[model samples]
Target: MLEVTLEILRFFVLALALGLFIHADRSVSYGRRGFLLIKIGFLLILFGVFMEITDQLDIPGWGMVADVHVNFYLAKVVGQLAGSVLLLVGLWFWLPSIRTMDEVQEALDRARSELEEHFVARTRELEAEVDRRCKAEAEGRISDERRRILFENSPIGITHGFVGGRFVERNRAYARMLGYDSPEEMAQAQALAGDTFSHIVDPADVERIVGQARNEDYVKDLIVRMRRKDGEIRWIRLEMAMARDHHGRNYYFYAFALDVTERKERSEALERYKRRLKGIFDSLPVGIFVVDRETHTMAWANPEALRMSGYTLDQMIGLPCREALCGDASFCPWGGIEEGVPCTDESFLTRKDGTRLPVLKNMVSTVVDGRESLVVSLQDISEQKRLEELREDVNRIVTHDLKGPIIGVINGCRLLLLEEESLDAELSEMLHLIENQAEKALQMIGLSLALYKIEAGTFTYEPEPVAVMDVVRETLVNLGGRIEDKRLAVSVLLDGGPDPGLGSPMIPANPLLLETMVANLLLNAVEAAPEGGEVSVGLEQGDPVVLTMVNAGAVPEALRETFFEKYSTGGKPGGTGLGTYSARLAAGAMGGTVELSVSDDEDRTTLRVTLPGA
Candidate 1:
């Protein structure tokens, strides 16, 4: 074992000596002698590899060539000795003591006396060589000084330190990196600055960086948190290099430091931002699915997507987008997404149980990774569908059952009115009032049915010439009882003359819809107005006809914003909160607009309806 170990060690030393001799030998006096010595060393290494104790070679002169002592072991020892001497003679102009000539002479003489005179002669010949070597060494020193100048002035941070955790040299850039005024200041504050790695906050990190540098003889982009002179911790990426100094024979660790705080901070902040955004995405009620444009497969699914699709997270990942979202659809939106168009519609998503879930989605086509991709935002509309069904049920009951009593009451009134001739004058007047009230109730029931149709989206627009004042007068007559109870004073003004329905003041609309809209607005005005206060209804004739209703009471500030929204209303007797909403729908159906204004200081409210002129 010891013999094998010594052989391996000897092999490395001889190999190193061969390389050094060939590289450093530059003198013309050697004349390829250094290269010849390298070849000899190479042959010895090959011998060691190919030949062992069990291997032997028979030649004309075994281990010797042409009367020369060319034995393998002796050749290896000689190559090492001669290569070292020649290489030293070139670089440092030094000679080794030659005590024997048998190592160099062809006859293999071991006598030192005969070669002593020749060695003396060779020594005299090398006197001039010493002078040349001195000149070369001086030039080398100048070159080294230039290198040192470049190192000091370099912008990149550079530092050199011994293994004992003491910095031997630092450039200006390195000193500035640690927040010192100058390199000298940094040198003086070596103890405070953590010597070699005192600024490294983590001891484990220090060990890692050092170990990495030692093992690899170089380390690049080794990030560490280092403290500055002001005690501010910053991230730095150190490129470390290690080497043995040929002059001192000591190991040195050199580092090129770069301030990576900004880049690292930005990366960390971006990562943090990604985490926060992912949290928000997972918390949303709407589902978001990203699909590959080429394959149309699910690339990413947010948490909401899993919930909305009724699929487990594992099921949703990598599933075909069409299969996961709308597997039952004949025409998939993915096909259209391939054309780079954005599409949105209400559709049904099939769940795991084959139950259809109503959904509304916005699918946009975009390019990603050199291919088309779809980013789908989904909303579950099941609740909206349920509410619509409930509303339809309510409307159905009113249409089929609730109108019977109103018609029966009207028929009873008609029978009593027919016997007016046999009754007294006061009783006849009472019967006439009952008949009018009953007719008004019937009209309200019919209007309710029409509103239901309008809500169901089954009502069609019927445009006809209609008058604002005529509708207003009919509403006042129908609501006469309520008006008298409130004691509200109402006034009507027509700007298009008495026959307002004949010309400019007339608006094109379904007469029934116009009447409903006017009656609701008039009722709101009457109900909001104080007793004995005025409700002025005015009709203006122009390119667009305007009907303005002004009441003596201001709308509540809180209700003003959502006054026209469905199911939005303030405290009022018999208020269903659908009056303004229906009125706005009616005006919209007739290509008109409705606007409300209030003067809180004056306690007044005005609703203006702008309609297309006849």
Candidate 2:
């Protein structure tokens, strides 16, 4: 009974220690360093209890004391080692908080030291200055030297020229701004409207400046053009005030001058660019309309916009964009485009004559009426769309009409290929080539028609349970000649299952469309495979059916990104670039997606199609 009670106490101590350790560092959630250190220290103290229990009780598998080789002595040593490590790691993580506290203490100490020194130095200077000031006042000495030094060293251009005529004194900066070598030369020259001031651009500007300074005793930021010492004209600003004696008799005019050439040029350039942009806006091909962001009502419309909506300048000035072009508000993007977000969409505009016009619309935040607003641009593509539809129509008609003749040609080639045993080797090979080419042409036409259906949004889809291997087999048989020509090793892998439907991968898809996608996949693999390399086709049916094709020949580096994009067939010989593109569209039509990747380093290309599982 005493042993049982001791074992229970040991177990409880170990459990409590583990609980503390688990809750010690909540840094990932909620944590306190001081509490964590204390928890770890307590855990170390209880670890010996676990070591003592190792002799009485054996833990199950996958635990610290579960091993048969781990007895009481080993457990005690391990417990000490692990406890030490845990305690160290916990202390390590807690040091940053201690350092933070210490750093604040150090900063406070330095701040106190600096404040004490500042006070002492200020007190000493005040005491010394008071004594010096008393001595100087008793000696009857005036501080005229400080005033003279400040006047000469001031960065601002200061002058003390007589009110109406000759110059008296000037600073170096004032003389330099006036295109003179020094203050002496400027002071020697007369301050009237002659050689001393030949740099001033206009006599009226001078009159205005003198008038403002004389009447108001102060003038600020009076801009004028002046010639520099190097004969270059530059802009300058003047701020001045008149000085008078105690009797109110004018003595001299004090002024400061600053170089303002760069600021002037930038202002002028911005104004000119704005004017030029305004002119270009009217002539732009795209329709531009500025509207109030809150109301979405057009405040201004450029000429092209007015023409696009078939509205005159006066008519479109204040109309809501919907009322002006769309006749309704349904086509608008939204309240307005927010900053950094542009809205792009295709919408139809209703003309005045009740005809609908297709337009590509773009809207973004822009400034209008001196406030934040929306700028909407519309590009008319109705003619381009009409032409595209017409071209597709022509293609559909041509492919539809040529089907019979093409099938007859294929049948004839197949018939000729059958007589290869009775013909010469060259003749037999030619016949085989004819059959292969004919079959490929038939596949191209069928794919083209299928793609046209996808684009026209009229593709018919009747999905039923389909054995994927059946279509893959048919595609392999159809491409036998091409496969033989390339001498490629091919394999088809299917997952093993008891049920026939599960054994052979099956998907819910249109049989004809599935066959077409498979045909394209097989044909592309055959073309990509090296002359005598290997190709593999794999299928797996589950929640989603995946069909994979891998070829030994690498896909070109240039075509990887646009492998499924239309008209992107560059660098591949005898390639229309439409095969993969059409396959993707066909797969999408059947609720599937086609993904492709190529590894030039491995000399392998892979294509995968995922379809809805049956």
Candidate 3:
């Protein structure tokens, strides 16, 4: 009986272990549901352990017989203790598995929810981007359509072609201008072919056109007679230019042409009229040059005019009138005439070789091409000018040579009267006045003689190697009395060194002319300076020798333009105005220049004289 009971207990324990193993498999496969199975299995294992303990102690018959006397109470206590331990262990393992199953299920649920939300949000963003791209494409298409319409409807003829000479596109104006019903038809007609376009050109002009277009990138105002679709020939002026492609291949040429048949006929008629009008221009015998006032260039020149100026039509076409004819630094000597004042008989022109040509010019302002222009005609009066100069020279010689002797006679008579002890007081006064008038006349004669000599290019110059410093010192000493009399201070600054060379030590120039020029400058400075004002003189040697004089007075604005002109002064009382002019002329004869400049601030005037080094 004990053996049977022990086997039955062992069988129940083995069945419980099998059930727990099944429960653990279910826990892994079925999540929270499997954990409930594990809890049920744990309870059954506890029951099986109790049954085994009862059987071992023989407390109750469980279909087994006892084989030997056993302590029922002690065995029952020991079996109950073992059952409690097994039940506790199984419960501990089952509880932790159940908790692990719960955590895994919670994590899976959260991940599923987050993934679905992310998928929905991404779909919406993609849809919005697609919509934006579609809208932008639609707007771009509309703008392109409008531009195409404008291009087709424009007034100017437009065409585009490939580098291979094939027409890619053209507009309605181009078709109509070329007498085609449509641009496509005109492009298909293939009008431009190997030099056939030259058929419209005159035989004599064909070579010129082809050569010009080949050598130059553009041709303008090319008049040609082209045949129309209706078999009419019309003169056209074509302006054409070449174009290149991205690959630098020669592309089709583009041209704008105007039907100039009427204009050409009118121009021919005008030529005939001009031939009739030629008599009027040629009859004057004097040269006539018509200058376009707006361009300041020559428009037309007569035969005699070209001869006088020594310029061909090709050389003269675009040249400024003053530059072509007059070599003067300033253009148009009749100043106010350029400002719409009619000019007549005052301005002089220069020749090709820098010679002055006297002319009687008549200018009248007129409007041409909606702009101001001058109609100028010139009459050459070079012969007349020469005759007048000759007369003046003769008169000067007669007056200057005769006046000195006359003055001597008057002075002797005055001295004789003063020596008479019985002479009346009024008589002595009259004699003194006569002597004064005679002296004035003699001075004028001397000035006239000097001017005549200068004009004739007969003034004598004696060049000698003299100490430049000595010459300057002497000039200063001679002017010391005048400087004191005028109450003006004179200062000289000289760079002292061995005279550079025979040419360096002293310049090749007339001593008298140099001294006269220096004296004139000093006198002018003295007159211009206020009482007790300062005057400065400086001498320096470089590539060229330079002498400078500065005075503490401003140049009057009125006299600035004509400062070096003969007989022009700022109206200072008793001022001859010839001193500065003659001084500059004398300097120029010696290959030197005398320049007068006012300070930028207009506070002082400076005179600079530059001469060739010795």
Candidate 4:
């Protein structure tokens, strides 16, 4: 066992000598201390192998070799050999890697220096760019300041405020226009002036402006009334806009104001002129109408026009003028006038009752609301036409009636002269009759002239105290011949009193007109009654005086409907159809009314005249 141990120790010394030699060569070449570690590691591996071999050989006096197997001994030998070779090869490979590592470190150090220099240059360039931008911004702010100063010095009013209701800026023009001496004075009194400004605006307008400022961020050309320092009101047109600042806050509101008082006054004056024009249109006496050209509809009409056409303005406006009122199918006068056609000739205007009135219309076309329209004026000529016809009839009647009377008078004179020698009492009597009739004919002509005067509204009244009974007796006496011829029985009833003189006969209304109307009514009553029929005349006195004439005759139903209409008579023989009409007109002129009605049984008809009493 000692021998084996001595051999193993000798083998270990040999392996260490070999490793030291290789490591010494590598250290000399590479000049690295790390090569010594490989030499030490090789020595430790050699020592472990040699101890195993010595135990296997069992050298004398060394120790006991404990179960040394052949395979273990061989493993020890092979491990020592492999360790020496690995140490030598490691020296060679590590020397080159160390030199290569030194070169790589040198290159890394150079690259790091270049990267640092480039980074530093890039940082400085960024700082320079930043500085340039900052300077540019500063210069831009200065330019903006100059521009703002120029704008503030101008005549226009400019102002700016913050969203939180603070006036941040205002121009001199704005402050002076609002009656302030300077912008500082206005800003110093911000709280007081703000309250005053809000108060000057209508409450609704203030709320609307505030809401718009908050929500919309802009408002423009809003006209509002503002009060000045002297308590005078003026109109202003306001423009406003909003802006956000760099801090991402909505901080500024800008506004511009212009005075519009003059314009407002002009508008008001124009409105007043329009009202005056409308008044003139409304007050015209003749019927006037205006029609739209496109629609051919009555766009505007005066009250007189509406009354003449028998339609309300609402029913007529926006309605085709002719179709709505006249119902004419062929040529509409209003439409023709609107189309600029001349219609100066006489035309008929139809009423709601389907009655046509003869009218002379004149038309002109003009522009209204930038559209062509027509204005029409109408004058009713029916009464003038009727008067002309009456004049011709009167001439004929007068000529015929006068001619007969003249002829009779001439004939009577001739007969009296020629037949005087052979004249008897009978011939003398006949000639006297002819002269009396001629005198009556002259009186009839005078009566006709009086009637014509009354119809023409030229008759005058002279009221005096007259006894009612005397007036009645006189009227009866005047018609006594006719009464006797008709054999009419007439009676008067003075009800409710023994007359008390009726206070001087009920205030003596126009005696002539009153007596004439009463006489006409009485004569008609007598003519209407059958023989033995009684006609009663009665008088009642109260606050008002009433004279009633009742006759035992039935009023024709058709005549009763239009009892007082002009030219409507009850078909009486020889009736001229003007008695009732003239009677009613005279009664109305005397501040009284005439009314007629028939009994339900159709047995009696009553006519009543009422007048104001003293």
Candidate 5:
């Protein structure tokens, strides 16, 4: 029983091993041939153990099955040997497949991890690109808004259009400038015009401007005449440029415009005035020249100026003023003349022939064409000068012819006076008056010649010591009749006092000139004194003696500047105006000066004479 039990246990152990092998076949993978081989080997081993158990039990049917196999133990041994061989062969085949399975699993795990990492990185990149695109789109919208605002609010007239006449956009200012209510109205009008600029711009101007823009692709500061909706013509200044695409083809045109009608009108008016002025200058009788201040060169010469200079306009245009007009380079009229002030004097002009012509020249500094310039006018004074010389000659001949006759009358009167004892008192007095009057006539003739010589600058000066006090007393006595007629009271003083211990003050002067000066001054004082007015004469004794004569009457305002000029008069009845003139000349000949002062406060006139004393 123990043996049977052990065999049975062996048999059960083998069957259980076979059952575990069959179960593992379902859970694990192996080639079909190898699995079949393993299953057949396990069944054979179980059958061998079952046969051994049956042999051990010695049953009648089991003996018969053993006899048919020839030996039960041998059969069991054979079956076990074959099963072991098949099991070993199956393990040999399936073990390499198991290693291959392990390698495939490791490779699949690595590929999955790599794919996960790549997917994560690509997702981040996609998100950043979306964010960047969103930011760019936002900035583009802002830029478009800014451009719209700028285009609408620009002050100057602005417009955009195709190269052909199709308008794209226009600002409010541009619309208003063209006399439209709004931009839309302007656009509607432009659309209705049917490819025409004649409705807005001058047709002729449009032709030229459009032609130029087409050729040059730009136009700047081009002035065009435009017509408003209300039928007013205006001048517009335009600046336009063409926008080209990347292929160098014109895409569109933009323009800026401003109204300049007032400026254009003013320019036209100025041109007209200049034309009139030039006409007048050409027809003038006197010579007129315009000179540049900085270069001292002639800029323009009128017709008269050209004729006087004996040169054509081309020859005189760029010549120096000193060379062309005055012939003295050192003496330019601009040197002494101030701006806006006129200078008039006598000067000589050198003609092309090298002959000097006398002229009275007037010069004034002024602005011409925005630059400092000088305007000079010259009047020929040759005929006037010749007539003055002729008059002087006649006066000289008359004075010479009258001197001998006047001397004869004075001598005859003197002879009559010498025989006073033979005549009665009345007859003797008459003869004496005749002699005095004749002497006065002779003195008058001599004075006339002396005056002529002084004017000619040919007078000979003979210096001698003269008693100024005695001369003054003699002049007062000579004017006594005039003083009495005017009812004037005359006063004389020496060294500011009534009388001084010193004798008559002496001055080194020509005796005749000294007497004439004193007499003329005193006579003028007497004549100018008002009725019942007073005249005061004061003398100061010094190295330079000063003589002052004051009268109650003041000089006339009109003649104050020319009081001592030759032939100047204040419209006094029978007044020669030569008293002050001759007095000044005689004083100047004796190296002296005569001055006149009018005191408005005291209503008085004072004549002061200063001379060298001996």
Candidate 6:
């Protein structure tokens, strides 16, 4: 029993050692070769123990046999011996490793102690940093509160959100601006679209504004059209900045917006108006220029003005008007005068080639962009001046050259008339008519100069009593050939009655002028009258005497307005067009006016002349 007890005790000790080895193996790593060797050694030791335990058991037939028992004992001894050898070998292999583990453990304990000390010190420093950060956070919160108040109450719209994402926060102004009742409503809509404000923005504008934001990370005063909640379109100007995280990654976008619909509309309207005005000015034949009042520089010049001044728009802008336009500054009507004064002048302008050009200039002061300015309108009058000079030359030739020959003819006719007694009645009458016709030619030559003077507003008037009946009689006699060719029925009336004797119901006018005027009317009447057409002249005596000449053929509709104007005529071959013009001028010179009226249904034209009565 004691032996058995000893064996049991031995087995227990071996088992306990195996348990300790397993515990150690779990806590520390044994190299693969060492682990395998130790494992085999321990298994052999357990096998020896198992054999010894078996030897103690009084069991079956095998152990009861002597040979079996001896074999078992031998096995037990071999197992123990092999186990002892293997354990020693394993220990040999594992000892250095165990020593290394022990040293590593010692070093680890020392490092752990140092780490604890450092952790304690670091905790204290962290506590101080936390305290400082907490104080700073408190101050920051107060400032943030004030900023929040301002952001919420600001008149301008403010919004914060992820770019291309739903809004995280929005100010009241932003909500109200978009016609939303509250910020939450706007946010709800934004979330539905999963975008910042693209749903409200015009599609084209969204692409442009968002593209700009992505490229620049900032947008300033970008105007976009956005639809409000109620479907109204509004113009919004956005100024935005994108926020980035520490790693320069996009975080969110914050934006300021203002409703600029009214201002934008006004600006657009003004731009359109400017475009139209520029079109008109460019189309005008007259040159228009705008000059600054304070700087005396060219503010604006129409296309015609630029062309006339021989300068490009780029070259003329902001240049002094004197240099750009009329070389002499003294010609500027606004010079040396208070702003807003107006003036007109006929002056000479210096062209780019240093040639003189006559211009009729009208200048008026105006205000532009809160600054006083001058608006100058000019017409090129070179053609008119040339025509006036030509007219003067013609008048000189008629007075000096033609009059001499005409006077000599009149003297020759007078000499012939003195010898009329030797001639028969027909010869004598023919001489008298020749003298009368020659005098008329001289009178007509003088009338040409008189008509020019009347047109120039330099004619002097001298009125005398003139017999209207005698003048009418003489005009009819002069136009007898034309009247006969047209087969016209001509008649003269006094106060709607038949023509009376000569010198009755006379008018105050030049006798020669009256005769010339009457002759022009009769000629026009005879020409206008159709074959066998009637021409009637009616005179009325009142405060102002009235002469009405009626003929067939109504005036053409297109020519009626300008019929009395100089060089205006229609449908008459070889017509000088100056007959009616001269007739009107002669009437005006004698305090008279002429008007034309047409009766389309009656197919007639009436020429009415009003002259001062005697």
List the candidate 1 regions with Cα displacement exceeding 4 Å.
1-156, 161-166, 176-179, 189-195, 229-233, 241-254, 259-273, 290-299, 311-355, 360-377, 398-400, 415-434, 454-469, 472-511, 518-614
lDDT of each: 0.75, 0.75, 0.68, 0.71, 0.81, 0.81
Q: Which 10 successive residues of model 2 have the least lDDT summed? A: 496-505
Candidate 5, superposed: residue stretches over 4 Å from native: 1-155, 178-181, 185-201, 245-251, 324-335, 415-445, 474-490, 499-503, 519-535, 551-581, 596-606
Query: Residue-wise lDDT of candidate 6 within 264-342, one digit each (tens)?
Result: 9899999999999879999998988888889989888888877777777887779887764554755554555555666
Q: What digit string (tens of lDDT, one per residue) describes model 1 on residues 1-614?
A: 66655656666776676566557556323335434544554655535533331123334555555676456554344444554454444333223212222245534454465588778877877876887888889999999999899889988888888754667888998888879888888777766655566778899888897677556767787889888889999898999878766654436788898999999999999999999999999998999888886776887778888877777877776777776576465666665554556677777776767677888888888875576678888889999999988877887786657668867877887898788789899988887787777677677777777777776688777798776666777788888998899888877777734433333346678887788899889988988899988888888878698889999989998899789988788978778898899999888877899999999898999999998887
Q: Model 3, 124-207: lDDT tens per residue?
A: 888888898888888889888886886588766555543324456778865666576887766556555443332353666656
Assess candidate 1 and give its TM-score to the true structure: 0.51
Worst 10-residue lDDT window for candidate 5 reads 66-75
Find the 10 residues in a row with the least total lDDT in model 1.
93-102
- Sliding window of 10 residues with minimal summed lDDT for model 6: 62-71
Better of 3 and 6 by TM-score: 6
Give TM-scores for every candidate, taking all chains together and pairing residue i with residue i.
Answer: 0.51, 0.57, 0.36, 0.43, 0.69, 0.47
lDDT of 4 by residue, 1-614 (tens): 56676766677677767666675663354534446545654765566566566556556544334654444543455455555565666666566767776887798899999999999999999999999999999999999999787767968778777764756787888777767788887766656655635424577766666667666667888887776555677788888897867875556778787888888899899899999978887887678878887788889888878878787889778877676334355766543554555556567677766688777777788877888887777777889889977985887587557867576686766667577667788877777777766665654454455555566777665666546656666667777787678777877777644433333355667665666677777777778877777778788876578888888878887678678877888778899887888788767767789988888686998998887776
- Which residue runs of candidate 6 sit more than 4 Å off their true CA positions? 1-248, 251-300, 303-378, 421-430, 456-458, 500-503, 530-532
Candidate 4 vs. true structure, TM-score: 0.43
Q: Candidate 4 overall Cα lDDT vs. reference?
A: 0.71
- Give the Å shift of residue 297 in candidate 3: 8.6
Question: In model 4, where do residues sit more than 4 Å from their true spots?
Answer: 1-80, 84-156, 179-212, 215-224, 229-231, 239-252, 321-345, 351-355, 380-614
- The predicted structure with the larger lDDT, 1 or 4, is 1
Best of the two (2, 4) by TM-score: 2
